[model samples]
Structure formats: C-alpha cells, structure tokens
Target: MSAFSAIGDPEEAEEDEFTPGIEPQPTWCPGCGDFAVNNALKKAMANLGKNPDEVLLCTGIGCSGKLNSYFESYGFHTIHGRSLPVARAAKLANPGVEVVAAGGDGDGYGIGGNHFMHTARENHDMTYIVFNNEIFGLTKGQTSPTSPKGHKSKTQPSGSAKDPVRPLSLSLASGASYVARTAAVNPNQAAEIIAEAVEHDGFAHVDFLTQCPTWNKDARQYVPYTDVQDSEDYDFDVTNRQEAGEMMYEVESKLYEGEVLTGRFYKDDRPSYGQEKRSTGEMPEEPLAERYYDEDAEWERCAEQLIDKHT
Candidate 1:
C-alpha cells in the first residue's frame, strides 16, 4: 500500500441558504482541551464578522500547530518555534491582513521562547496564542516550560527541579501591549478575549490553558477560575503596570497550588512596530503585498533595493 495517506474528503454537509459547513476533523484526542481553542477561534471570528480570506493563521510544530488546519484562513504551518517570525513577516508584507499565531507551551515557551519575548517586546500587530497545557502533548507527555516544579514526566521522572516560566509576567515585562490568560473550560471568555486581542492595535498575548488528558491528567484541573475583571474581590486596574504585575505574580503562584486564576492581567495603548516604522518613513505606507497586483511592475526594481542594501 502507498505510505502517503491523507484525510478523505468530508461528507456532504447540510447546507442552508447561506451556511454550508462540515465540522473540522481534527486529530485531537477525546477530552482534549484543543477542541475548545478551535471552537473559541471560530466564535471569535464570527463575532467580529471577519472573512476567512482576510486573516492569516501561522502555527508552529506541535499539537497546537494543527490549529491552521482546522481554522479556515490563509495558513502557514511553520517549523517548531518559528511561527512568530513567519507571522511577523506576513503582517509586515501586508499590514491589512489580520495575523494570528498559535503553538503549544513547548513550542512557544520552550524552543520558541526567545521569539515570544522579542515579539512581545517589539509590540508587533498580531495575536499570539500559547496553548499552556503544562506538558509537551504532541511529543508524548514530556516536561514542558510551563510544567510545574516537581511534576514528574517520562523526561523528568524524578520530577522537575527547575521552576516553571511565568508566562503572564514575562509577557508584561517583555512589552506585550495586552496580556491575558484563559482556560479551555471557559469557551465564552476565551472567544471574547481572542476577539479583543485581534482588535487590539499592538501585540496581544494570551496564555491559553489547555489540558492534555491523554498524557497529563494533571492538566485537566484548570477550571473553577475567577475572572478578575468581573470579581469585586480582585480590584486591580488592568491598565496599571504595577497592579497587573502584582496580580500576575499572585496568579502564577496559585496555579501550582491548584487554584486557576484566569483573566486579563495587563493592557497598554502603544503603537506597534509597524506603526512606528511607518511614522518614521522606515516602512512604506503601502504594503509590499500590494505590489503583486501590479503585473507590469519591474521585479528588478526590488532586486536593485536588495543590492543597495548589501552594497
């Protein structure tokens, strides 16, 4: 038999006057929290009335990377820990396109961690969703960057002695214009937060809490979370850096203690990298992608600029 195999064509889906859809056939396991992320993105796009063609979804290599396959959009499945650069390039080429990048905790917080920090620091105009399931789900339950201290995995059977990364705190400190945490259990909140991120003018990061029930059953306890915005008990201004930083410290501390504190922690109204470049004439107001529409445009002209850059 031929070794190369692909998913067969989906069955004929029921069609209404304006709606004809077959659900995505993802490979996620039963009870996997990834399903929630998929649903949330769909809801968010619908809520925003965004067309599939108007968006670009870049994903890194991991279970979460399969997001592009499920979401209907211009998609790029990039190498492990490399989706952010790809997303940034796409956005730079076409500032009009709504760009989003997704990857698992291991893909984003581990191998791609430097990209994560710099992308936020630059305040790129994009949304980055990190599926924080606390383990490397696609790689068979290995210890991930967010894996709690003393958490035992096949790779760390003796239990991890290293402290886990504080994603929200790191996001804030590294200059993410918006930072938030949401769990798979709260689909409504997830969709809302994602929508907000997409609408934001600068880099927006969401540390999405997912569960790898097949590999890490411990990840399943992310629910019973309280939204800091809706609760009177937690009165901290999200726009205040000091207040948000304090709140994030508290939230990160309690997560390992089995208390899932999920909510928006910080937000800042800052011009994105692209905006700054445009303001200073470092970048053209017209997107480079628009050049493709000019069939008569000389390709040699761009090559001349590249030569000029080198010489």
Candidate 2:
C-alpha cells in the first residue's frame, strides 16, 4: 500500500477525528475571522474523509501560525514566510502525504511572498490557504502588503502609499493550477473551496478573506459577499485563463469598493512539480521514507550505515 493510503481510513471517519483530544480553548478575539478559517478547515477535512495522520499542515508565524496547535494533524510551525519551503520538503520526502500550507496576509503575501510565487509557479502538489486580514493582526494592527492603498495603520499613519498586491492575479501569473478566493464569513464556501483545493493534483491557492475585527474594524469582512459561481451576474468560465484573470481583476477592485466576490476563479490540468520530476526520472516513485525499512537499501543508506558498510 502507498504510504499515504496506509495513513487514511475514511470509511468510518468521524468529524471529531480531526479535533485534538486535548484541545485548548481558542484565544482569538470574539468575532475574529480566524475562527472561521479554523472551523472551515476542520469541516473540509471531515467532509473529504481525510484522517489527521494522512495530512501535514505547515504554517508560518502570525496569528494564522497557531493553526497547527488547534488542528489534530502532523504539523510544522515554521518561521515567518517559510512555511511553503518546509511543506514542499515534506511533500517531496513523502509523496503520499497530503500537504497544506497556511499563513496570514503579512506572513504569506509579504514576508513569504517569494516562496508563494515560486511554489505556485512550480505547481507544487499541495494546497496553500492564505488568511488575508489585510493587516498584521498578531503584531497589532499594521499596514500589510494586501492592505488598501489608503488604509492607515501603525506603520502607515498617513495611509499606505503603494497599491496592495492583487493576490489572485499574482497566483494566476505564477502558475497555480487551481486558484480561488473565499471568505471566513461564508464558511460553506470556504470549506468547499478548501476541499476542492485538497483534491486537486497540482498547486491550489485559496486566498481566504479573514477579517480582523479588533485590529482592522474597517476590514473587508464588514460587508456582505457574493459567490461568483452562485451569482447570476458572473458568467465567465473558471477554466479560461483570460476570463478568470478579468474576473479576478473585478473582484480585487470590488473588494476595496465595499463589494465582495468569492469562489473559484481558475483551474487547469497541468502536471504538478512531483509528477514532472518523476516523469523526467529525477525522483523515485516510492516515498523516500520507505527506504528506511529496507536495511539493504544501497543508495539510500544512512551516513553511518554507509560508512560501516564501506569500512
């Protein structure tokens, strides 16, 4: 059996399976959108019949970094803006594990923006969920890369001078095979998007809009949202790159205008990084960890074992 399949048993899976046995009460401010993200993630995993052991969640520093502590899974809490690289390594080492990386707007779009871009560009076989609160919530309210151009904060008291990064557009340009945006306020959509991202064979980028009610009271979550797929006004196809790009532009523009549009924007069937490597004969088809069980593994021997064998 594949290492991944050996870890999963969904036939009798329970929703509570993803909940930690020794769960600590969440300390996020009441009504904080981070709550929505946590809830939706668990709901999605449960619906997907994914056991905690079958999944690996990697997170970066910030309020979003606390995710692994709350969720029951094999998790890694990496430094600021480094979750993607760590997640990538874990996936490459164990091709059967389901990988997911998460972080806040600042941690993801700002500090770790380069990693995000390249990970999407390479079409890594994993899911990336970004909690976009538009500001740095953990370090107190501060201007962030996705903060509106004129939004004021501790760092930008006179309002930000630069334009906020358009995340969906950037993801599309960088080569994410699946791109979607969902909001914490709409838990159903968030869960659905996350589930879809997980099932996709290539890189899936979900820009999750999580409101920081205490830090950014005027945050985008203050408004009602419309799902593009459910809305009659939106008629573009999600599979078309040009249509998706245009739609994302409109959504980004509308977010600053007190309007919210959420849902899947783009999807493609391109090969993932692992698939490409394997096709090119650069990586093994089996999980790297499997070699440890075989003492006769000639090329994959441990350093000490190799030294002893040679000597």
lDDT per residue for candidate 2 within 1-311, as digits (tens), equals: 64454864554556677777776466788888888888888888888888888889999999999988888899999999999999999999887888999999999999899999999999999999999999999999999999999899999999999999999999999999999999987988899999999999999999999888889987756458898898899999889999999999999999998899999999999999999999998888876767766677656447887799899
Query: Could you tell me how far off, in angstroms, the CA of residue 28 lies in candidate 2 after the best superposition?
Result: 1.1
What is residue 274's positional error in candidate 2, in angstroms? 0.3
- For all candidates in order, the CA lDDT equals 0.86, 0.90
Backbone clash total for model 1 is 0
Question: Which runs in model 1 stand beyond 4 Å of their true positions?
Answer: 1-23, 296-311
Q: Tens-digit lDDT track for model 1 on 236-284?
A: 9899999999999999999988888888888899899999999999888
TM-scores of all predicted structures: 0.90, 0.93
Candidate 2 segments exceeding 4 Å error: 1-5, 8-10, 300-311
